[model samples]
Target: MSGFACASSCGLIFKSKESERNVVSLFQYDGLRAVESIRLGAIRCDPKSSISTSAAKCGRIKAMASPTVSAPKREKDPKKRIVITGMGLVSVFGNDIDMFYNKLLEGVSGISPIDRFDASEFSVRFAGQIRNFSSKGYIDGKNDRRLDDCWRYCLVAGKRALEDASLGQEVLETMDRTRIGVLVGSGMGGITAFSNGVEALIQKGYKKITPFFIPYSITNMGSALLAIDTGLMGPNYSISTACATANYCFYAAANHIRRGEADIMVAGGTEAAVIPTGVGGFIACRALSQRNDEPERASRPWDKDRDGFVIGEGSGVLIMESLEHATKRGANIIAEYLGGAVTCDAHHMTDPRSDGLGVSSCIIKSLEDAGVAPEEVNYVNAHATSTLAGDLAEVNAIKKVFKNTSEIKMNGTKSMTGHGLGAAGGLEAIATIKAITTGWLHPTINQHNLEPEVTIDTVPNVKKQHEVNVGISNSFGFGGHNSVVAFAPFKP
Candidate 1:
């Protein structure tokens, strides 16, 4: 016999009809949704029929003596419901999200010739460059000079997100500052600064290195500085997972709110790795496209003639909050953050596992975490970076997880934005969320020759209207990092 272990009454509450020794205890009173709690109970017990006999033996069932008394369940906790309240971005297409996605749907390429530092002599001479970026409201002239471009991007994105969420200084003062957090991240934080510092040290001397080198170059400073500026005393940190950096930050920030560590989180990723060193390093590994003549078509994911990924740089951020918190504040919720997951291939440092085990498992885990069924998802923002092996590997992984399902449609955002390394996932997430709100899926663009192995819909070459109830975004990184995040349209 099994029963509820209450302080007043601890006795067997349930038993199989065939045997007294076969006692099954039902775990009770979960804070999850009704369906999930029901699944955990595993067995049904009617209080009128089963508990009546044991009512005298166990007093806890007296309150549950109704005929409809089934397995234990509880109401869904509002604190666990994570929702997106605001979004902010810095991209080559444009900082305004509507314009950015519109250009993407129109099959416009952000990749162009790199002018940041003369790259005419480099192996690959092109990249996705954001024309002009400024953080006037967030920082002063002196501080901007001291900080790296990556840090400046983080500050601007965070400020824009707060403004979008209406959590400016006047509004933020009303909330509990201790329960707010910042989770912004970067894969190659201040790469330009590091490269400049090294050059200074080599050409001049060790004394020539700037005093701001250590402070601005570290990855954690992005989140730390945001926390300092906003007075968010809660969890603050950064995650560096190469291209998966943004999704990893999103996953961690959502959980921080879900776990009650914070009520609101400013989370996302940023990067500015288009320096000469950045271009040369990838060129050394032969990981960049060499189509200097037709840079626009160089980042052709799944194309037969595609060479490699085009490096891009930008920042993307989202203000995340528990549904209860946002609703209490009357904040305008943009979308819902359903769930997300992360994994490591452990098969190779730079390449994915040939069998595609890691990516496939991560997608399934993300779906399970979101408590969503396979049929509910209609769109996926893939992480194909236009590489020969990478595109097929991701598609093969998708096939394994979502086998024989014609309902799902996917596209590669890298075709337009190029690969932003850490910031790619952030920008792609904004694109996916845009689809949920606008009912449009951006085209994968340059797929003149689609690979035969990809049986699913690639949404090639043209943007189309599709009602998207649920969407998921994928981002894979060097060092075999795999991350997936799920989203749903806000119901209420």
Candidate 2:
């Protein structure tokens, strides 16, 4: 028997002479191709066989063909479901998830002057800075100075998530640690560390730079450090799709569970790029709000006088477990992760498709993947970063997907927490979970007047208490990356 392999953009497919057997494998790399070579001493096939002719048509096929190997068939186990067990967040609004939720419900704004570093000379000054986060409590004494701000945030958030899930060390010790995983992301990784490291390298020789510089600056270190701190040994990686970083991380983590690679995963995002360089770069691009006099009202998404987003720093982590695993351990399921979808605009590096074609497709795909109808969506957490074009594009997309339901309750959490960049998705996901669990929808504060172009009924001022069985969170970023996630109250 002869075997053939074909590679496509999505995956690789291998077909055997025995037509009944075939294997398909999804690949992360886009440039996958099939390479064929013959083994001289391998099993010889009849020269006149159809398999031999098939081998001749292709470049070359290995003579050896062990009984056609097939990939394990995916079983539709209705008993197994994916749910959110625990959530932890360190946002500019607060340190704990409950504090953040309460502030959101009260329509409090966290934007303020850039206090981390002097930004007086910059065009933009306000940002969402985590006020009272202390690294000493989360990081080890010896490693505190070596870690970056993003890692510090992830460590704290990850620990809190584990504790909230009641997965103490004693419990983890009994479970298969190898079956647990971590997927954390950051848009700018360690911009502060990178900037400082470069300055040190320029001032002194190579020896002057600390050995931890590279490890602290790379994006994956957040996930790596979380795994080390939490003793999780499953699939671990970090995604960087500009501001869509965390949403991609959640999507990837869910696939890991769906593919049976892990039973429980610690997945989310962390971002601490609120330094001088970080702020100045966005200011240069004119992508930051310049309402310095009234920083609180600067991030007015869908408002007529909206300027741009206020850079925010923090982390949000979620503990996701298979329903089977959570039930086996009697874990408290916070919400069910219905599913999510991601798409690229392929239009612009920083701007979204003018008509929001990409965003609409992503939302529709996410709803389809989650098997939820649009009318059933009770609330929407928008990616309205207060930018003019980006906000309108998203609004247009929401209208196209939700249709007459565009009047549904929608809120821009970024109005409260500022734009967390890569961490926005995870943080917003936590907000959505809280909305469903508490029956409260956070408000889009700071909108003094609605923009004429915006037709949706955006909830402003105080939060609204209502039954929200299903919620959708939208996150779009630079590079035209669009991601949408759906969450629902866990009925079971």
Candidate 1's residue-wise lDDT over 139-167, tens digit each? 88998988888888888878888989999
Q: lDDT of each structure?
A: 0.77, 0.74
**Model 2 quality (TM-score):** 0.83
Summarize candidate 2's per-residue lDDT along 29-80 as a digit string, tens digits.
1111112211223323344533221231111121121234332222235334
State residue 153's C-alpha deviation in candidate 2, in Å. Answer: 0.4
Quote model 1's TM-score. Answer: 0.84
Using TM-score as the measure, the top candidate is: 1
List candidate 1 segments past 4 Å from native: 1-75
Q: What is the TM-score of each candidate against the true structure?
A: 0.84, 0.83
